[model samples]
Target: MAYLRLFDWYQTNKRDLPFRKTDNPYHIWVSEIMLQQTQVDTMLPFYDRFLTIYPTIQDLARADIDEILKVVQGIGYYRRFRMLHKGAQYVIDHHDGKLPEDYFKILKIPGIGAYTAGAIMSIAFHKPYPATDGNVIRVLSRVKMLEDDFRLDKNKKKLNEMNKELIENSNNPYLYTQSMMELGATVCKVSNPLCDTCPLQEVCLANINNVQQNYPKMSPLKTKKEIQYFTFILEYKEGFLMRKRTEDLLHGFYEFVQIESDSLNGALTQAQDLGLEIQILDELQPIKHVFTHMIWQINLYRGTISNITSPYEIVHDFSQVPIATVVKKQIKQI
Candidate 1:
């Protein structure tokens, strides 16, 4: 692959991330899982805190799910943490509390997919495995001047195979993997790539053709569905009434009383049906929250509730509870 120059560039220019400083596979695995959706800067503090709390995978395995949820409250995508928790337990029971060294064995753990497994294998074990994250894909797609749409499964498989061969034959697997990722994130960006600063400037076909932006062509995305709802944070005796979510993606999280409605009166009617007796105080501003598949046009409100017929918890402090990020956004300032 002739990536020795790329390796040198990475050593000289890579960001000084905490995970990169450690050879611990568990630490690198945690970083990979967190970095799956979050940017490095936003995830740095949480990473440090999480490691402080759970110094070892064994510590995570013994921790409660509620505490784990609280630790990563604002991070979003809580399912990953749940899976990581389960993976820790799995490693304890099957791998003697040690992160598996083999790629396939690591993949057997929950929440670890191909990219994560590859990252752990190469970055931690220094094995020759292709870690084709989004950044890596973009960088390689441009370097090879690939015309195939990377969105398609077959095209992605080809890219993996190509990079797999490159890493297997590279001067150093760990450096090559991180170097490709660093180059994509810093040099060969999705927009306005820095060709002059790129180590692979001479070999990049996208650069040779002067159409770097046109190389990694992606398919159009499906439109996210949008919905409107009215949500209320009803104050009770010295506290606010909220409910713990027991279903779907937000399971094991807390949320305010929300009704899928367009009007305040209609929302109140829905609330009445659910055995909620409330006195309307005032209506605050509305908020809109977007998810991967749907958009929530939430009409936010605050009021006092005299009594509750259904099961609901009275929370004195919202911060003390592991509320969903959407609910946290609408927390009533006391």
Candidate 2:
């Protein structure tokens, strides 16, 4: 009864997303990868542009990694793009230019984890696999009145076992998996859930006990590490000086020279250490950029220099360059 009602609700209410128009594993894989830690609306433009650029797995495999990153630049989580490129190449080399249907084999691909592997297997291949994402976890936790810490491996294992049963018993595993995820995303949300409109409200243990907000229990959130950045957007002639990072974060992404210092004096000291004669034109409003675990308090400064004294790429046309999103915002302010 629960599965039947959920499917019926989904069929009538599901959003007509581009990815839902096909059962192709390749398209589904792209959507799932982009959906991670990103909102659907935020991903729509990137998804459409991405598919337009690389319409097929073979096309993706043949494309350059830098090109792929350029396409997905502002969307962030560049590592996912790297994995997508590598994984597509792997498929072309080993799987005949097609994504593997087997769950375990999908898991073997880099950046393709249990949830993503399960999602592709069930949604694209109609396999009886449970794609247990955070949405599924939330829905199931409320349905069963579970109170275990979600970060614990034992709890995740137990939840996966329960989802396995649900999928195995489902008459249409593909629809069932999508419907469950849809239900959680649209109705059974993390806060202020629409319990009255939820299909499983009648059987939901948390709803029955009037504790819907407390079922999916979790530990308190961690404090974000605070850091300061002094961004210097120095212009010489018609171009600005930009450089690619060799660090783990935002690797290969272009940005204006930034000094990691909290005070103006420190920033000036670092800028002088670069051995470049620069004149400070004016200061701009500070910008704040937040990451998953860190908060960047950015201090923006725009200036001019007579010549390029440092080894930095001179970018005259941004259309041809893939600038970091954080730096892009700063440029807009100038």
**lDDT top scorer:** 2
Total colliding residue pairs, candidate 1: 0
Model 1 lDDT tens row, 1-334: 4577898898899999899999988889999999986788888989999999998999999999999999988887889999999999999999999997898999899999988998898999999988988887888888888889988988888899988998988968898889898898889988999999999999988899999988688998899988989888888888888888888768788888888987888888989999897687777777888888889998887889888655588888876778877886787432
Task: Mark the 10 consecutive residues where model 1 has the least summed lDDT.
Answer: 325-334
For model 2, where is the 10-residue window of minimal lDDT?
304-313
- Over 258-285, each residue of candidate 2 has an lDDT whose tens digit, in order, gives 8899798888888788876668898999
- Please, what is the whole-model Cα lDDT of each candidate in the order they appear? 0.87, 0.88
In TM-score terms, which candidate is top?
Answer: 1
TM, every model: 0.97, 0.96
lDDT of 2: 0.88
